[model samples]
Target chain A: MPVFDQGYRRFEGTLRPRHALGALVWTAVRPRLRWWLWLLAAILSFYPGLVYAAITFITLAVGPDAFGGRNRLPEASGAFVAFSDNGDPSQLVAELLAPTTAGIVARLWRISEQCALAGFVLPAVACAGVIATDRATGAHQIYFARPVTRMRYLLSRIAAVTVFCSVATVLPPLLVWLETAALHDDPWFAAQTWSAPFAIALSGAVYAYFVSGVVLALSSTLRRPLVVGLATIFSYLFLQVVSAMIVHGLEDKRWRALDPQYALGGITAPLYGVALPDWLQTPWPWLVGLVVPTLLLAYVWSRLRAVEVAT
Target chain B: MTSTAPVVRVTALEKRFGAVRALRGLDAAFPRGAVGLLGPNGAGKSTLLKVLLGLLEPDRGDAEVLGLRVAADPMAVRRAVGYMPEVDAYVSGLTGAASVRLAGILCGLPGRAAQQRAHEILYYVGLGEARYRRVEEYSTGMRQRLRFAQALVHDPELIFLDEPTNGLDPDGRDEMLALVDDLARHHGKSIVLCSHLLHDVEAVCEHVVVLREGTVALSGSVDDVRKLERGTFHVRVSGDEARFRAAAEAAGMHFAAQDGETLVVRVPDGAGAREIFRAAHAAGCVVRRLATVEQSLEGVFLRAVEGAAEARA
Candidate 1:
């Protein structure tokens, strides 16, 4: 037998018990992440706040009369009464708060629009390669060969994507809500709708589920990261656009069943107290919303095995 | 060394891939030090390794590695042992040291300890400078050594090296075999080298377990396993070969093979060439050449596996 002097010393340190799973969360993911994705998340985190800031400026500018002053700024028409009203600024502010149902829907729609925009794009992009790359490059063998189980492996991988997506989707809206409340002097609205924080958290959770569920399922099925990412983003946008077009063209609430956006909006709209027209309140959208994530989760359950097919 | 239990004691181990049976009642006990696991392609060697590592659940039976029952406490087995897989497997976009250190931490080492060990083990495997580079940029030999380093970074008591020299050249292959030998002897590590190359096994292994059709066909210490029949010698002679054979038989010598002027003859265990020389002299045949030919590992392996197949049939 051939022998060479290695001069290697034995490791005389104590090993922690059953720490492989925790270590996986720390070191399982390769640190060389796409910098652009994080940049996008950071950029997305500013969206709700930016929109709120812009709207706050606009509301303040358009309704300067509401601050116990006369309309000294600009003149407006019948629809712009909040701005054109030359009455007591306090009365004008209360009048704006108790606007018609259509007015509430229009304002709530704008918030939903921003949330939907970030929620759809951020989750799809951030969670694209959670498991796909592991399968692609045969890293699962490296993990499984350690003291980790399939469940721990899957959870960590999901957590890697889920946490990042939550940063982009959940945490931002929460911050934006705080910023909006702190800046706004609307006590009546705050009393009636103190659940804004909880609603943002719930909506953020919905977005995270879409990411961890559908995107993760797609990741498990494929071997290429780029392909998984594109597939996720494309599917999210495609289904949202197609369902919206079909529902609008038909002018039928029944056709809205296919729209995941509609379902998310339905759940989101109630939190904001947007009075939904009875024709637009279809449970199919909600059911589809739940079913899609459930099916994707089930797909992941059946697919991600220990001895995965070699790369 | 104080532990008397076998390094690995597997009984009736069975694993299946859907309808196809991968391991069918494989029973073998691997001992300490370098033990080679030899098998043909698809003979369930990889499956056995995965099962022992707890990467896959066995369909039936029990297995214990390093005195830890795999079925009952697989994490303990994984904690005590390390594995270098057969395929190209690594977390992409990681430097060799970073990858090895991550493997160490995941195997239960603290970060600082894992980092120190990673550097030491990488240096020990002759990749001290190369460890700074991403694994994707490594040569085949470097990747093999890197994987070996990862397996050692945690100071595991036992390691499973699967196809360690798969894509190496002759010199690299020699280097890998030498490393295996050094690790087993100097480092006091027990290793299971999974390879299809018999020469590699013969070079590094003190004991061997051969698998065929998911069962142990032959297993023993390398010396006994490859031992030739006693006093067997192949003699190539020029004059009166038949007369030489008859004379050899008359002298109570048994001939093993005949091909042209070449003759295989076996004397008693302790008997030497004196008997064959005397018989050749009596026959008046010129003994052109005579030498003992030891049975090679390839011969032993082919015979064992073929014999098992015949018995199964």
Candidate 2:
């Protein structure tokens, strides 16, 4: 028999009080935050500043007469410059821009909602494969062999997607809302628009949870990230198309409740203190809207259970 | 080491998966140093490892590792133990260094500490040159070394190495075995090595746990397990065969000389054949050849498992 010797030394180092969730968060975000995302952030950060600049130019150059007759901003940019300033210049520009609390709330909702949707797409792609890739690569063995539970594992992933998506969804609208508030000379800006930030926050959070649940659940079933990302886009588009056809061709407004996009919009109306449309006032739309996503999330939980088996 | 209880103890452990009972009232103990877990397919080797790692729950009874109750604090049990599974795995999109570093970090090391340890362990496992390469691009041997590196990165107190030499050439297999030996002997890390290869177990392990039908059929030091009974031998001779047989019979030796000029004799262990030689020499017979027949580990293993089946039948 040969004497066995490989010179493996015992390490005398100490293990730190680890932050597992924090480490996972760093890994998920660091790789996806490329130059393209930075460029997007720069644009979002300055858009409100650009809006303030545009408002200043219009208010000073065209004077209050530009707001003389129109209750809304110019529908098209080309016609915006040539509209004759013939009406009497009696009202202030700010006064015509936001005449009441309802009017300003509606504008904030529309802007935040639009930014939220745009922000949702890129981050969704980033998070689409987080759970799926882990299972596909058998990396869960490395994780579960440590001191982590399944719940913590799932939460860290969800939190990662939420934080990533917020970069696009949550941050932009609040910055724009702040700039809009600061530009207003009206004293009612503070009193009337106080709920605007909170509403946008609530809307972004709901959007994050819903999207993360659906995308990650899909992720658990598949081994490929490409499939998961494509599925996410397809599911959203398919739901919209189905609901649109029913609402347009069949003349049945209740089917709109099943539309994820429409449901999200209606769900945010109460947060912004806007009333639901007459067609969406019934509970069927809300019921299917909430139930379908919940069922999808349940499917995710079940799929995660299967994915947890390391072998 | 014998006076104290084993480092791991499973008492009356029972685990059932659907209609299959993977473990049935199983009981075993493992002391420190290199121990081999031997069992045939579906004999509960995988399930036992998972239970000890706190990855699966048993139906009844309990297990203890490193003096901690596994049920009370499974995460703590896992924290102290390193595990190398049979599955081929890599962290997607990560280099070898990053994957090992993440394993350390997930096992509770700080990020910087984990990274430093990763560099050290990669070199230790002979993966230094391939540390920067993407894990998915690694060859079979390199990936095997990477798995070993990940298990060693945390410097765990005890490690479970499952099928460590599953798919390797002779040289690769020998190198892997030597590394395990060093961990057990030099570093003093307690090891539970699971493999289907009997020679691999015999080469390194001092203790053996032979599991059959979800229960331990044989458990002891390998030294005791491999001992032969009565030291049987075969001797070939020619001159004065009748006189030698009479003399051997009178000397109270059990001999059967009718198997074609060969006498099969039983003697005490390590005493050699002094009585037979003396009888043959006194009877004017010259001894031609004498050889000791030792029992093999395979015989012991087959009897252990097959014996269990016989008893069941």
- Which candidate has the highest lDDT of all? 2
- Residue A252 CA displacement from its true place in model 1, Å: 2.1
The positional error of residue A290 in candidate 2, measured at the CA in angstroms, is: 4.3
* lDDT of candidate 1 over A29-58, digit per residue (tens): 445257886788667655554554454445
Mark the regions of model 2 whose C-alpha exceeds 4 Å error after superposition.
Answer: A1-19, A31-96, A99-105, A115-120, A181-195, A284-291, A309-311, B1-4, B228-296, B308-313
Worst 10 residues of 2 chain B by lDDT: B250-259
Chain B only: TM-score of model 2 = 0.79
User: Residue-pair clashes per candidate, as listed?
Assistant: 0, 1
Question: In model 1, what are the clashing residue pairs, if there are any?
Answer: none
Model 1 lDDT per residue over B1-313, tens place: 3555679989999988888888999899999999999987777888898788776779899999988888888888888898888777877778999889888887889989999999888888888878789888998788888888888888988999998999989988898888888889888899999998999999999999989888888889998887744477778776787798899898888765555767777787678888888888999987888887677787667655655566669
Alpha-carbon shift of residue A262 in model 1 (angstroms): 2.0
DockQ scores of the candidates: 0.39, 0.31
Give me the candidate number with maximum DockQ. Answer: 1
Against the hidden reference, what TM-scores do the models get? 0.80, 0.79
What's the lDDT for residue B202 in model 2?
87
